[model samples]
Target chain A: MNKNLYIKELKRNRKNFFVWLSIVFGFTLLVLSIFPYMSGMGEGLTALMEQIPPEIGKAMGMDEQTWSSALGFYSTYYGVYIVVLISIYTASTGAGIISKEERDRTSEFLLTRPVSRKTVFWTKIAALFSLTLIFFGLQTVLAGIGLSLVNEGTMDWGIFTRMHASGFILICFFTAIGVLISMFFTPKKNFMGMVVGLTFGTYFLNAIAKSTEATKWIGYISPFNYMEITIDPHHAFNYWGAIVLILVAIILLIVALKSYEKRDMAG
Target chain B: MLAIETINLSKLYGENRGIRNVNLKVERGEVFGFIGPNGAGKSTTIRTLLGLIHPSGGRATILGHDIVSEGVELRKKIGYLPSEVHYYDEMNSRELLEYSIGFYDNINPDEIEHLADFFELDLAKNIADLSFGNKKKCAIIQAVLHRPELLILDEPTSGLDPLMQNRFFDLLEEKHKEGTTIFFSSHILSEIQRMCDRAAVIRDGEISAIENIQDLLKKQMKKVRIVFNPDAINRNLPIGSQNEKWHDQKVNFEYVGPIESLIQWMNESKVVDVVMEEPDLETIFMNYYKR
Candidate 1:
């Protein structure tokens, strides 16, 4: 869709966008710096796990762990927080992409230009993608930098990259959902609020249902559960399930685009 | 081919109707005015023509392209200013114009610069920092600098002061002289009277009348004056009745149709003076709703 047009729109509204990215990356940097300290707690927690029921360990994906390394810290502790943060941040970004124009009443002016609605939609999506990647990459780099200076270079880059990969996947997945919501729903603020509520509620339901063997599959229903947080890439990153979710989410996004193409803008 | 034509167009939002059964033809270079009061659906008709809203029942064409089916192509030749301008808050005037011009393939940067200078709009000021009128001027420049063939303005001077509003009208006149079909919606009859050669008054999602400004004035209407003489009243004049009494003089009113009945009623030797005023757009506008 027009890259120049997308860049122009972002450049026109760069202040808020800059603020949004700064918050995302600043929070990411803060969280990354503290995660190592939190890993010390993970070590203590793993020791405590030894005294708990084995069922608890099996259920939280903490059945096996080195406890002190980044991988273990990520597996048993950081995954939940990371997924939650990614979902919220990405959804906010996506919702802002379309709904912000409506909120500001600028969509009528913007869409009246010579571009097609599909082009405008894709341009916004591209701008959001670029913004998301820039912050995600910066946070990842700062995490690496923080690790080098503070951790005596003992940090696990593989675990770090894998975690980011999962985070990125989750972000894109939610972005697609956000686009769908933008396309289908009226420019009502409550829709974003509802989506945020559902994201957290789904995770809670999945975690609560995992105790039963028949209900274990409910965890797979949430994108958060599909990212695999067991400290073993082979066991944790459920490749087949993630691919399935991604494909399904992508298909849903296509439907959203089609709906946008057919529906009249709320002019 | 005409610049814009709506073929029996109509739109309805559920049971709440917008402009219904609207049929309009604008030639290649004519300023067609759309006049209506509040909730008159003037904006609705403009939005449907701009492809911002779909025609629930009929169709509109812009420069030979169907607005609904060929919107992208049709929009390329159209410039529009919404009733309430909404712009990117962070963009200064120049940044907004540059960003807007980047979308069109045939834009000339120098023309935009000239328009900005002509409108006395500072390009370096951010839109949010500018006053609402200045922001509207920015929107107008962005809409017109590309020199679109059809200009559909919805309340184009909603925020501007009279001086700037006149300047905008001058700009519109220049565009019209250059063969741009000018179409705009307004509730202010005085402004519409000034800007348009032919205006259609819409009332309650319907076009009440389409007529030339001069034609509306020619229709015989009430003309009244207070005279100092009560006994000089011409009883033979079969027209207006006495309005009120001023001191001892009875205010005589009568039909002045064809300007002859009043002339025949007045005796040049007896009348002290004469004061004649024509019908204004306000009276014509009220008469529109009364029908």
Candidate 2:
């Protein structure tokens, strides 16, 4: 990877990174900080939880434990809001990372420089995942701090780790899909709508699949199905699923790099 | 080794667009001009050589490196100025130039400041706010700051005023003196006439003719109009004159031979007034196109 290009890519996306980071930061803290208050209402919240439609609760990965523990409460939001928000930021960024140069017509200037297309491609990808990992790690750390501060009772760190691990894998899977999608579309296209649609659309697919026994087969098509974020002590982390998703991400990135190498930069 | 060489290089966009079977050899330190009108495949050929676009067939080399397989190394020695400049709008001229410099090795960053000052470009101004001419100036500096061995310039002076154009040409002349091989592409005839040693004429995606600039000028046809005295109406016209037309006491024709011979013929005739017109390059190209 070209260091200079990698650095420039990072610097270019700095503002967008900070914006998304703050949103994730706020959401993580809001979910965790509110957990203590919800748990204090204890039986009252449990009564409220029972009143919620079981289908709705299942769709959102929420349960009785959602009002009982900090990690359980955070896990509900983690599976739906937090992971999807981070994925949207990362996936949209991945879509635009390379295509933006073509859209802006600066590829001519860049490709003519003393750098191979391969170098440029991998450098940008390196920068992209670096941002992804940082974003994912920071949110995890923030949630960790919030969870510890709010939970007066002993918390299950293993479930917390498992939930975040699955969240990271899902985010990466979506981000790779974003990069692959950009390769097929015209550079001038705004990828935000498509990226958002793919992330939310797949999340809803998993949610609907989980809520109904009839549609459970549909969950197989979504990466979220393989990488579950529900904080259940009975279900272990999906190590095999994580490996498959990572391999798929790698394949998507390689396909994108191949297409980028051969593309004729239109002036 | 040649500075630039292409063997049957072709890039067909679809059925009839882009360049085709373009073969050229530009010698080291030679100022070779590529003359063509817009959409005449000049930019297509250059872009293919620079590896911005993959060639449909055939191959090329610049500075002894294969354009396809060795583009990165070859580009290290090449300086290209595109006709339409598009830079990162977020960067100021200094930052853009600095980022550009980072792509190569051993480039003195101070050269960016020097070139910016020389071209009267304000380094602090955002690229989005700069005028076309100012952007062109920035591009010019970016192209030459590294003192590259081969300069591929496409319509290099289009946006610059005459003064900046002159300054640009002067800078090019200086680079030429330092043994830089210039591949200049322009439709403007005067600029080619001033700088080119030899020129290749491309039209409709193919090369029609490649001739020495001196030979081309020597063979050029001039439009001539002569107003003769009434007494001289029946006199014979010059030897190299063609399509002579008589209108009362005045005659109009095209002269295609040596200027001295035409002058001598006129001196012997009873002429009251004479007008001579040098046809522009487009008209000369039209002659070739018609053939």
Candidate 3:
């Protein structure tokens, strides 16, 4: 990877990184910080939970445990908001990282430099995932801190670890899809709408599948179905699913690199 | 080794457009011009050499490096100035220039300041805020920053005023003295006439002619009008003069011969006044295009 290009990519993205990071950070804290109040309501919240349909509760990834424990409460929001939001940020960034150069018509300046297209491709990828890992890591760390701060009872570290592990895999899977999608589309296209649709669309697919027995097969098409965010002690981390999703991500990235190498630098 | 050599280089976009079967050999330290109208495939050929677009067929080498397989190494010695400058709008001129030079080694950072000052460009202004001419100045600075061996310029003076154009040509002269091989592409005949040693004329994606500038000028037809003394009106018109017309003692015709012969012929006649005009390149191009 070219260090000069990698550093420039990182510096160029610094401001956008902060904006997304703050949003994810604030959302993580907000979910965790509000848990104590919900748990304190006790039977009143339980009564409120009973009034909602189980299918609706399942669709939202909520349950009785959502009002009982910090991890359970946070897991509901983690899957829907934190993971999807972070994925949207990362996936949109991945989509734009290389395509933006062409869209801005700076590829001529860049490709004319003493750097191979391969070096530029991988260097941008390296910078991209570096941002991805950092963003994922910081959010995980914040969640851990928030969980510890609010929980009056002992937190289940194993379930927390399992849930976040699946979240990381899902985030990577979506980010890779973002990169691949950008390769097929015109450089001038704004990827935000597509990225939002992808992240939310798949998340809903999994939610819909879980809520109804009839549509469970539909979830198989989505990556979210493979790596699910669950606070249940009975459900273990899907190691095979994680591996498959990681491999798919690698394949997507390689496909993106190949297409980029062959693409004409359009002004 | 030749500075650039292309063997049957072709890039066809669908059935129409793009260069075809272009073969050229540019010697080291030669100032070669590539003249064609817009959409005449000049930029297409240059982009092929730079490896911006994959060649449809054939191959080329620059500084003895294969354009396809060894583009990175070859580009190290190439300085390209595009017709339309597009830089990162977020960066000021100084930052953009610095970023550009960071890709190459053995660069003098002081050269950036020197070139910027020479072009009278303010380095602190963001690229988005700069005028088209200012951005062009920035483009020129970056192209020559590393003292590259080959300079490829495409319509390089479009946005610059005449004064900057002169300064730019002066700088190019300095670079040429240092043995830089320049591939200047433009539709402007005057610029090519001023700077080129030899030029290749491309039309409809094919090379119609490649001639030494002096030879082209010599072979071109010049419109001549001569007013003779009434007593000298009986003298014979010079050979090689065509389409002659007369109005009393004044005669007008097109001449396509050595200037010395035309002058000698004029010496034989007691002439009162003479007017000669060389047709512009567009007319010359039309002559080639017609055939």
lDDT of 3 by residue, B1-291 (tens): 999999999999988888899999899999999988778899999999999999999999999999999999999999999999999999999999999999999899999989988999999999999999999999999999988999999999999999999999999999999999999999998898888899898888988888888777768999999999987684477888999999999999999888899999988779999999987766776676676
TM-score between model 2 and native: 0.95
Tell me each candidate's RMSD, in Å, in order: 3.7, 2.1, 1.6
Each candidate's fnat? 0.79, 0.87, 0.77
Candidate achieving higher DockQ, 2 or 3? 2
TM-score of chain B of each: 0.90, 0.91, 0.94
lDDT of each residue in A1-267, candidate 1, tens digit only: 987777875664566556755765666556556656766687577678789776566656455453555445444544555555556666766766777777788878777887887898778778877866766676667656755564533566666677777767776787778777776667666455856776776666566556567677777667767765445746444577668778977797678767766665565
Structural similarity to truth (TM-score) of each candidate: 0.86, 0.95, 0.97
Q: lDDT per residue, candidate 2, B71-189, as tens digits?
A: 99999999999999999999999999999888888899989887877789999999999999999999998898788999999999989999999999999999999999999999897
DockQ order of candidates, top first: 2, 3, 1
TM-score of chain A of each: 0.79, 0.98, 0.98
Estimate, for each residue in A202-239, the C-alpha lDDT of model 3 and write its tens digit: 99999999888998998999898988697877788899
Over 4 Å off, model 3: B258-264, B273-282
Going through the candidates in order, their DockQ values are 0.59, 0.84, 0.83
User: Which docking band does candidate 3 fall into?
Assistant: high
Candidate 1 docking DockQ: 0.59
Q: Which of 1 and 2 is ahead in TM-score?
A: 2
Q: Which residue pairs show backbone clashes in model 2? A: none
RMSD of 3: 1.6
